[model samples]
Target: MESEQALESEAEQGERLGWWHHSHPTFAGITGFFAGMLFVTALPGAFAGLLRLLLDYETAEKLFPFVLLALALPIAMLVKRKTRRFAQFMFVGMVVTALVVLGVASLVLYFMVDA
Candidate 1:
């Protein structure tokens, strides 16, 4: 009787803590958003750095267009029903981040040129 009671209590505790093991509902969206931001910012810089390390400037510049192939992964994710929601959030993040960066950059350039 004592052993059975202890086992039941453990099972109840496990059930209570099970949600801790699983991600929250927003986890996917938040993760996808940050991932998209990083993909836009860091991925290109890292890719360029790697290319420069391995090849000359002329060769790396010629090969840089190949980076567009990375778009296929997100396109594939968007096509799949299971990943569509995360992919959508990722796209939103990418577009917003890009717009903000470009807007600030252009504003700064305009001010500098005007001055």
Candidate 2:
């Protein structure tokens, strides 16, 4: 009975503090923040690149920012369903996305500087 009560109260505390995935609030918030950052930084550029390369579209870059909501909605829904899973997926996704974006950006910079 005592353990059950403690668990109940702990859950209540988490609810009060905006904890997700039944873990502490801070960790969830930090993961979500970085995930959002990755979405903003990489996803649009990725979409633009695909459109340009695969579809042979010249003006797709101008529309990349508009797809921000399209990219974010699925992740938001996944978080709503399961926070821990969201955090795990987002952690990996963010790292990969950031690396790709940075790698391309660096290559572009290198070419510009060399020229």
Candidate 3:
């Protein structure tokens, strides 16, 4: 038993594992979920900000539709076997986050208008 343990440790030391390999089982899910949230929230804001910085308001608004192109990256990830699981979690996170944000925004608007 001790000899086997020693061999296992030696083998582990011989090859370095990548960050993904060394991470916890839930790491991928958590990371993917947060990535999706950021995708929905920050990515658009950052894209819009970049556009506004480089172009006039009219041009920026016109080009806003192009942000949809980013969806292709997640679709590609879903098609790949290795990343499919992460992509699935990311999709769920995106939907949930969007729903929550929209719900809260509507509630705030309703109350503000009523009061």
Candidate 4:
């Protein structure tokens, strides 16, 4: 029911969904790191003693910023070189790291919750 101009405007707004849109290179890495951290950190006692109570939900929300920082710093250091390679490496590393973390966390959760 919308006019052509309205449809065009909506498409433009959709494209501007900011840094984490799939079209953005870092989106995968950014999401992966946090997802991995969440899995590993979800165990009730995992971070309590060592982190001394920094494992709360509010603190967990900071994971995204931390991952972004991790990805950005390394890329910035190599910005003058082959950026595509750097991006690929960082994104893949982030994804792999997340998968490993998630696997471990799931195992832990499975044991803890089931038993």
Taking all chains together, each candidate's TM-score versus the true structure is 0.81, 0.41, 0.82, 0.35
Q: What local distance difference test score does each model get? A: 0.87, 0.69, 0.90, 0.57
lDDT of 3 at 3: 100
Predicted structure with the largest lDDT when compared to the true one: 3
Candidate 3 lDDT, tens digit per residue, 12-113? 875555545555588779888999999999999999999999999999999999999999988899999988878988998899999999999999999999
Model 4 misplaced regions, further than 4 Å:
1-67, 74-81
- Report the Cα lDDT for candidate 3: 0.90
> After best superposition, candidate 3 residue 36: deviation in angstroms?
0.4
Kindly give the stretch of ten consecutive residues in candidate 3 with the minimal lDDT sum. 15-24
Off by over 4 Å in 3: 1-23
lDDT of 1 by residue, 25-109 (tens): 8866887898889879988888899999999999999998888888888889999998887898888888988999999999999
For candidate 1, give the lDDT of residue 78.
98
Better of 1 and 2 by lDDT: 1
Which rank order by TM-score, best down to worst?
3, 1, 2, 4
Clashing pairs in 4: none
Per-residue lDDT of model 4, residues 7-80, tens digit only? 98888888777545546776655654554444334532343443445576666655434434444554563465
Number of colliding residue pairs in each model: 0, 0, 0, 0
- Candidate 1 at 72: error in angstroms? 0.7
> What TM-score, to 2 decimals, does candidate 2 have?
0.41
> Residue-wise lDDT of candidate 2 within 47-103, one digit each (tens)?
777777865454675655677566557455566656655555565666676787799
Cα RMSDs, all models: 3.2, 9.4, 4.4, 16.7
